[model samples]
Target: MVEIKIALVGQPNVGKSHLINSISGATLHVGNFSGVTVEKKEVEFERDGYRLKLIDLPGTYSLHPYTPEERVTKEFLLNGEYDLILNVVDSNQLQKNLTFSWQIADLNKPMVIAFNMYDEYSKRGGEIDTEKFFKLTNIRAQNVSAKENFGLEELFKKVIKTYQEQNKPRIYYSEIIEEEIENVREKIKDCRFDKRFVAIRLLEDDEDIYKIVHEKPWFVELLPQLNESKQIIKNEYDEDDLKEIFFEERLALSKGIISQVAKIAKRETLSEKIDKILIHPVLGLPIFLFVMWLLFQATFNLGAAPMDYIASVFDSISNFVGKFLPDGILKDAIINGVIPAIGAVVMFLPNILILFLGINLMEQTGYMARAAYVMDGILKRFGLQGRAFIPLVSGFGCSVPAYMAARTLKNPKDRLITMLIIGFMSCGARLPIYVLLVSAFFAPEVQGNVMFAIYIGGALVGLIVAKILRIVLFKGEPEPFVMELPKYRFPKIKALLFDLWIKTKTYLKKAGVFIALASLAVWFLSSFPRENIVKEYSLKIAHVKSEVKKEELKEEMRKKILENSYIARIGKIMEPITKPLDLSWREDVALLSGLAAKETVVSTMAVLYGGNSSNSKKLIEIIRNSLPFTAAVAMIIVVMFYSPCVAAMSTFYAEVPQWVWRIFYTIYPNVFAYFAALLAVSLIKLFS
Candidate 1:
């Protein structure tokens, strides 16, 4: 079968990714573009006896790159080899989206326009004449609703037809701009780019294009004419910046085309109605907070039932292993170290899924954008833009992707500040730790609220840090907030389940390898240097007639062995430093292991506390009875404010290259967390 490579392009939140996900039999592969940190996603599928490959370019506002993601998109479109351009536009916001459409259309590539979200558009009494759009722009158009999987087959057919026909766009700007384009076009003698596109870019004073043209032999000769053409356009438009003039021209043209081809059926948009309350200046923040609280409440309460079942299953497995294997290192390792550690991490799967599900729903329903809108004013006061909220919220899922999501912020300072504080958002890996600690220390009635408070408190602290960074490191006004609020729609259940499955699979995969190995290593440190303490205690317990006396003897032996183990020695060395925070040796080990991965914190605790036992209740009971309440609060605060895992640190390194900033990013969070824990312990002790 023949293969057609199409580049998918659009503005952010315009259903570009949703369209790619909607296609049948399509498999998406994500990677980075050459020499750039921006993510590149490609979707491949067999359609109509042809293999269609769609390269989902980063969502960019225009060819004039602003952010790193936009630069990647622009570079790919200008230089990368693709059979055709598949420009996806939001049908509801044609004029604004089509302004970008016109920019890409200027490339004169074979193209097809997909009016995505057509279902929502038509429901609002809006109608588009595709034939009329074709007549106006000379580009084939399809009204596609990727959410509903409507008109997708027809859209692909058009894509194939456009590829086969090799039809270039016939879009034209105003006559005056065209005259200048032609005037500069003639002087461009030898260049790889289309003469028309090059001429227009030259007129707009695009530095990237200017550099390319300047390297040519014809550049010195053409420079004079380029100046003349730019002057003429500037004089004609009464504007100093030809780029702004061209932008206005394109905007005017987009409006003109929309007026000619689109029929407006005036009706109240669902998004508008929902935004009245959800984005209301006063009620919005409170509503967002309540929704977040409810999300955590459901995650903890609903997940508790399944958590018990999973714990019981692990217990049965441990019991079965103990019955079959002889008392040896292998049996002890499996029962005491591996099984309980894995069980502790696995039991929180339901909570992770519920949390991700809520996040996915908010994103799919378009409420995520409104959330940014609702928080923009408050964020601005903290010297961050509204766009930072997306990445900050995504940090709750994982810091790796959240770091990548910071690409949407055009300003470098804004992006850097956002990346710096993402650790404070408390990702899913940290959820198990929070849940474990909360359940052990807090009352059942307030466990969910405590979890909620940890997350919100971290976010609050992040904002304060952002404010300080802006004042100290990056002193400037926050960038202007401009974002497209996509129309609200019912989330597809299939897509939601698929996303949740991916999250669950990723979590399990990480647990199986990273957490398992970390647990084994931790077990080695905590269980080794075989002392005679266990044997001596066993003899004493064997002689004790009273059941309580024998149980107490066993507990004493367990504590003695743990205290003398290698991990305990390591923890002891650091005890003085962490003493103010009131962290026990076991907690110090767990927190240190968390630097590797947050999930391992819980795994380390499980292996340390449960030791040779499969009963989870015993572990929780031990912690509840032994650990002081103030220390528990301090530990939670430390986890909330500390630097993320190694994987997240690597991602941050990839995103940021400055050595000074990278070093600051690494050291400051831990220092802040230590001090915060210290303060928390002190306050709690005073109040108690």
Candidate 2:
């Protein structure tokens, strides 16, 4: 049972990540640190005879008790049971850094202040009396550069010392704050927390924190009185408002501390002065578009060659096995099912990794916050705050984690709306659909561009739908905004790999299982003998006369397919029901059965028609060449806007409660997808 944990805490964009990378000599993940998508990262290293575990917490300006991230930071320091907390701070911004140090100070956890960016501090003419910092705070503080890998030996030594220290001092708030703390302490004698931290949260009116107070036996009598006192105090000061009060105080305090400890010679920093072109509306949108265009370009085009090569490799393997093995069910299983299933998943890896690298690039450079800032006005009309841009961007990596990112939004309604639209953002999971669709529907002109357009198409439609839902469903003014825009910096290479690893893990976890199982299921369905209607008639037609007549009959077999297969029988049962969808039995069967996992149609086509190779393309050409254009539209629209597969449905239900209004979750968008595709198909025919 030998184990130890250390925590890293800092204001946003200090060298917290830099320090971790230097200390562990391992890649440390860097992202906007907040929400449940947020968590402390732990990496273990053997440094000088002791196993060192470093946990990186979410960034915050202060723990003066507001915002989910601040709460998460505070709770982890107290709950994560770390032996030491590395209070990472900007050497150039000493005062604002102190607020986090002071807050962790209250937790009384053993900690070492790894004063980061000493070079930045010195260049800015900042001089820190590290000894004075310790005298005021009673915690060990050292100036070190996470960027240069300087002072890590001393940093580790202090870390080891903090771990071994038996007499670590417990700190508290001013007597005024402590008196109320004592009352909460006596009441929470039965509850848990660093008695002092709970008191501060109670003072600041944390809704969840106060609820915990009322549950304590001794506090039940005092809860009402305590709440009354808080209200009385709230009336006296604008300071205790529910939003950003702690943040504002931290900013003010940090600015004050910066002047005393850090110096700036008034030379303009690189990014702070870049507002003229980058943030200007005409120029800004175009630049943002260009940047993202490059991102999607790199993700698709750069990855496509690799993607095609991988697809080709899987195709070759399946064919090689089929040619070598005897004609039997086992060969069918190996060639048709197993290979395609693995291919379905393997093709996505390149795109997922590249897109994750792009998003991580944005997050690390602090462009993410800027993107949100620039888009806020436009995003507001859709029932989102400026910050919703972060989650939407994250969806390109994976939607489940993107959904988790929604918790960062303060408004619950907006968070739910973000989650709902996120799945439509064209994740790497959707890329296989694009690969199949573009290859089938059009020539290879601008293949990456076409795939990129499809991604934008889904995002555009998702946003429009979200705006409509917002207007008709949850109409209200969105909350005001105050987002931290950390100064842009070079994205660390290690952080990029760490991000790639995280997304790769998520992609496989969510989509891999279904693709694998669906491959086998589809092969099983394909291996069975054709059923009563189509099989009977296909057999009946076997004895036909002329070569010309046989060719004509073969062409007509698509009709026999409708009359006779097991899939056909299932479709006919629901045909009268789906006619508004302009769906023929072929489309209907594919739609109904494939609803559980949308990719099933792709696998099913390969199995039902014959080999999944370019052979799958011939099946599509046959359908398109015969089935009315409207039918093709119905198929595309149905899959695009339909109820997401079972996984998305389960997530929606789990995240959202079952209010009567929840019927829209089950019905509205689905019927909309059905008819939209149907109408588009009809319009195409009518125009033709």
- For every model shown, the clashing-pair count is 0, 6
Which candidate number maximizes TM-score?
1
Q: Please give me the total number of clashing residue pairs in predicted model 1.
A: 0
Over 456-521, each residue of candidate 2 has an lDDT whose tens digit, in order, gives 877888888888878877877645677777766777786678656766665566556655665566
Q: What is the C-alpha lDDT of each candidate?
A: 0.82, 0.65
What TM-score fits each model?
A: 0.79, 0.76
Per-residue lDDT of 131-233 in model 1, one digit per residue for the tens?
9999888899999999889999999998888888998889898898898789889888867788999988888878999888788998888899888888888
**What is candidate 1's TM-score against the reference?**
0.79
Judged by whole-model lDDT over C-alpha atoms, candidate 2 comes out at 0.65
The reply for model 2, stretches above 4 Å from the true place, is 25-40, 61-71, 167-192, 207-209, 220-268, 323-326, 385-419, 422-461, 471-480, 526-566, 590-640, 643-669, 677-688
